[model samples]
Target: MVRPKEFDERVALTAAMQVFWEKGYEATSIGDLTERMQIARPSLYATFGGKKELFETALRAYVELSLTYVENKLRSMPSVKASFLAYFQGVIEGSGGSNPDFGCLCVNTMVELAPHEPVFAQITEEFEARLTELFRKSIEGGIQSGELPDQLNPSSIARVLTLTAIGLTVTMKMKPSPSRVEHVAAEILTLLE
Candidate 1:
């Protein structure tokens, strides 16, 4: 009987993600993935099927990691306003870290492949929907708690914030200046009040 794979799946995926995130889907070769993941070609295929499948897996992994942290900040923070701030602050900090300046995997993939790939388009749509829903909930909560304007339309405002955040993520890749991101974030938070 064949033994199960020995290496950590998450670690391999993370390594693969960093490569894909840095180079994008089309630019990333099988050789690059194997080199970055430090696994043999057969091991990679055995574990992740193939290049396309591995890219999808990496995208899903990135989404899960990123969304979990955002959700936690939104749920645990003392106030909706603070929660929004914390969420964006996390993005700024995460993007600025020593890791590749890949912006966001979801955003990068959406921009690069969504036009030509229906599956990626659907994934991008879901990502946006989830982010919009999170902001909508927070805005609704803020309104209930008297932190936001009574007239604020939660759905509309949430869409605006979601798009703004996506714009920021993409911008971070081109110009990863912390001060500029912080300035833009300040303006975004002001909308909540």
Candidate 2:
């Protein structure tokens, strides 16, 4: 009979995610995960299958954490445009300081492994689709509230904004200057107004 796991999965996953986020999937070793997770190798394998499986868990955790922020912006902000601006501002502000090497995990995975890994490609696509949907919904809300121009196409504009955000995220890895990043974000936000 299998025994119930004693360790906190969420805590372990958070540590694992941090390790994977700091180091790309290709570069993260099993030793790294085990060391970061503070678990035995046998226990890690038993609970999470293998390095790939653990990395997938970490990816899911990252998405969950990100979505929490997105959901908060969507539900609580006074206006759709304001919520989106806040969201992008958060992204710009968050991608700074000591960990500039690690950009958005989803974007990093797309650049590093999506071309060769079908599973990672699908995961990345899902993340992009969800982000697009969030922007599309915000655009639709803006139209309904008469905040955006009537003729504007929410779907296309959302795609553009999403792509622009992704570009900014990837670019942050190369250029950590807050002013430059904010400038690019300002241009993107101009489309909304």
lDDT of each: 0.83, 0.80
Per-residue lDDT for 1-193 in model 2, tens only? Answer: 9888878988898889888889889899989988989988998998899998888878877876676667677666887767777777766766322244577888888899889989889888998889888889888888998988888888999899878878877877786666677665556778886
Top candidate on lDDT is 1
**TM-scores for candidates 1 onward, in order:** 0.89, 0.90
Model 2 stretches astray by more than 4 angstroms: 1-3, 95-101
Q: Tens digit of lDDT per residue, candidate 1, span 1-193?
A: 9988878888999999999988999999999999988888999999999998998888888877777766777887888888887777666666434242577889998899889988888888888899888889889988998988999999999999989888877776776655666676667898776
Alpha-carbon deviation at 144 in model 1, angstroms: 1.3
Residue-level error in angstroms, candidate 1, position 70: 1.0
Best by TM-score: 2
User: What is the Å distance of residue 32 in model 1 from its true position?
Assistant: 1.7
Q: Itemize residue pairs with steric clashes in candidate 1.
A: none
